[model samples]
Target: MALWGGLGQAATVAQLVGADVGGLISNIIQAAATARQNKKECEQLARRVLMIADLLPHLQDPEVMRRPEVRRPLTGIDDTLREAHELVTSCQGKSAAYQFVMAGRLADRFRDVQSRIDSYLLVFPFISHIDITRRLDRIYNILLSNDTAGPSSSAGSQLDVLVSQEVLVHRHGVGKFTLKELVVATNNFAQEIGRGSFGRVHKGVLPDGREVAVKSLGKASSQHGWQGLLRELDVVSCLRHKHIVHLVGCCVVRQKKSLLSFWRKNVEKQEELLLVYEYMKNGSLHDHLHGPSSSSSPSPVMASWKMRIEILLGVSRAIEYLHDYAGVIHRDIKLSNILVDSSWVPRLTDFGVVVNWDEA
Candidate 1:
């Protein structure tokens, strides 16, 4: 088999190995297409194996493939694909009686291959963060295409919600919240927490009882404000890190209303954009340093030399991560933008003015 044939090869020749493995996976997929027994299971296995095949090209970098983390999963995928091929090929050209006798066993084999492929793919390290972001954008586009196909059924809506929650929250580290949902969470925007160039922040509680800070875009009507909102979303959605402020999700509300006037007046449509973030209960580093909290009876926690050092280190690491791993440059890094969580861990925020290093 191709799997065993490629073993014991030099790590530096990973590109060649990846190509060979990909070709084997293609053959397996082709074999699965002709499967008579366990047709559904065979198709499922093919789909899972294809996902691995899609990732193989990205692993062609010799240095990346040499890493144990990457190499082990690639090897596991190879072995699983080999077994999958054998399982699928066995089901082809089988007599009905033979298929019936071995149906359960074949089904188990397919399930095992599917499970192994999924586990291996789960551990596959993303070689490029930009590529990951692009993939996520493609997923979001697919969702949008489905939504615009036609009027949605309840079942379809439920599926879309499930997909959005799973793919957006778990994979992309973000969520999509509706305006009505935000209204209920924020008590109709009753509590004002802070303000920024883009919008006003309101304190809110999510349906799951988690506190959040909702920034309602004040400049949605202006071209500059609209661009800022898009820029912030573009930059923040792709970032996932410990010391970075987690973007819970965003809400975009569009409404059409007619303007009745003596002069020429038509329907006006506007989008209300809001970004939700994890609530920083301890507030900003600026608040602790120069605000009322830093007065005569200052917060002892912020006053601690060790705590301050840790906070500084956390903020520095966040900046370093942005520059190195994410290829981002946060142009507006100020004390006020450095939020502190309940544990006093500093989180870097306000990416509205951030730029890609390439662009910078």
Candidate 2:
């Protein structure tokens, strides 16, 4: 059978209401109750499905439902709910080994369903115009909360689990580095190469004798900074391309310290986030275009029309890859963010603010 079977047909509100949405919702709830693994994710999906079910009544008005905007999102929700039902049901009565093996895939499926449902809710017109706005907001907040908690938290330990277990093992071959290893590699942060809004960059030599540029998140002690670091890691770890900066590995360390109080002594800890990438010997495009020289002129390479065109084409290809294949937008695109290797191949770096196109 086709996935999202009903999506091939034009769906009317009456047909959707009279059809299997209610049945699908009920099945999802029952399946979630018996889920052996990913139970919390299943339950969250069920709640969001029920909330969407409540909005169906508001969408049933003949005039409002006739509009393509309203009908299309409703149809999408219907299809998504069916998928959710199937996903939850599959988790029931499975053997421990089966569940363990499928845990990561199941989690990814749940996250995809939740994201789709959230998107439909945002685009569904009646929710915003009617009395359901507050309910919609609650559902939206629940989705956001689920997204940022547990495996998605900015805490060093949680991020470590996400990067090492989920990302490193499955998607890319990015490794996890220790603080001591990084300190030794960078000579205790001795050679500063560059700096950006998030942190400073340093030149380092890996134990393998490969050169790398290390970006340290200077403000990771604060909540916002930690979140930004998490965002960058999450985006960059999954991407692999010739024109994109390669993520060699990452380091997340929690450093402990003791504090003296008037009454007693206390202990505290802070996390440090760092990303390692292949070193670009030629530096950033901004430096070639604007950095000072004895002759007060741009670099010979930058002054060449042929070289500039080649650089532009390389950058364009990278952006195209990010949009068409990777489904992400590089929100930060600038001369300084684009680095070149000795071969003059441009590498797009900095993804702290990158967002999925759907979310954008």
Candidate 3:
């Protein structure tokens, strides 16, 4: 009764919904009752003990007392007896249906209680019900597989695992975008404005007539799960610079999909990573520097001596800001990665392969 009350009180403290708590408590009580019934059933299955002892000679050895084979069996027997005693002490106050059903099952696995108990204790509860269910399912699959498989796969790399967990727990306000919206914005990834080692970029026009450039990365299959994408997301989401091209928004499917991080930080409220940004009208400096028109003509629209100097100065300042203020390194510092806005204001774009050089 005391133990039952303690569980009931714990349920209350956990703030479980009345319906959920009611179900859990009922199940627990049912399980306890089933244990008592199993004890009674065991009395009738006297032949079961003989068969078990025959199959497990370890139970006969004097050292069996210290071995799991003997300890588990004895422990199960003790629990069964105790459960029966408790049911009788209740004077039939609670239903014994749970006990009877539970005992039938326990009797079937009478030799494996220690393993089951060890497994049950290792499962840590999660705040999300889905997480708990997933963990339990994982455990069941692992056990069912007889330990042949490796540990369950996570969404990110080991470091990324920590970041994802922290974000879910602490960064609750962050919104996730979908792949469809990105596809639509980027015109099915057809208008190739720029290309990089990681992916390609295209010019896009949002519904409100706002211009944006969307970078479509290569497909990520099972080879690059959440952690790989998550590491990229974590790094890109937090980047902020006046001259840096902003990440406006991104979207991805939970299980299998590409990730899109946006940069759209308002003047007053700045997000360290993840964004929606003001788009640049003109394409990257690469389009003007080594593009077909620039390479053939030797003088693109923005490649005049005067404009070239301004572009160089602008890019230099952008690099300095990222290096000094943000502690970031623009590794691929070629002309093509730089963009010119409507006012000819140059912005540094693409940090997909950037490095961190805080000291320098």
C-alpha RMSD between model 3 and the true structure: 20.7
lDDT of 1 by residue, 1-360 (tens): 333233323233335345356556778879988887778888888777666655555554565456665555456455667788888888888899999898788777777877778787776555444345555565555545654574345645454455444444555566788888999999999999887667788999998999999987774356456556656866788888999999888875533211111012221334466889999998988888877643567775556999989988999999999999999899988899999998888998887777888898
Q: Among all windows of ten consecutive residues in candidate 2, which has the lowest summed lDDT?
A: 256-265
* lDDT for each candidate structure: 0.70, 0.71, 0.47
- Candidate 2 has a TM-score of 0.51
Which candidate has the highest TM-score of all? 1
How many clashing residue pairs are found in candidate 2? Answer: 0
User: How would you encode candidate 3's per-residue C-alpha lDDT over 4-67 as one tens digit per residue?
Assistant: 4334333331232112322333333444444433445333332322222222221222332343
TM-score of each: 0.55, 0.51, 0.43
Better of 2 and 3 by TM-score: 2
Ranking by TM-score: 1, 2, 3
- Model 1, residue pairs in steric clash: none
Runs off by more than 4 Å, candidate 2: 1-164, 219-221, 254-270, 295-298
Q: Alpha-carbon error at 203 in model 3, in Å?
A: 2.8
lDDT of model 1, residue 360:
84
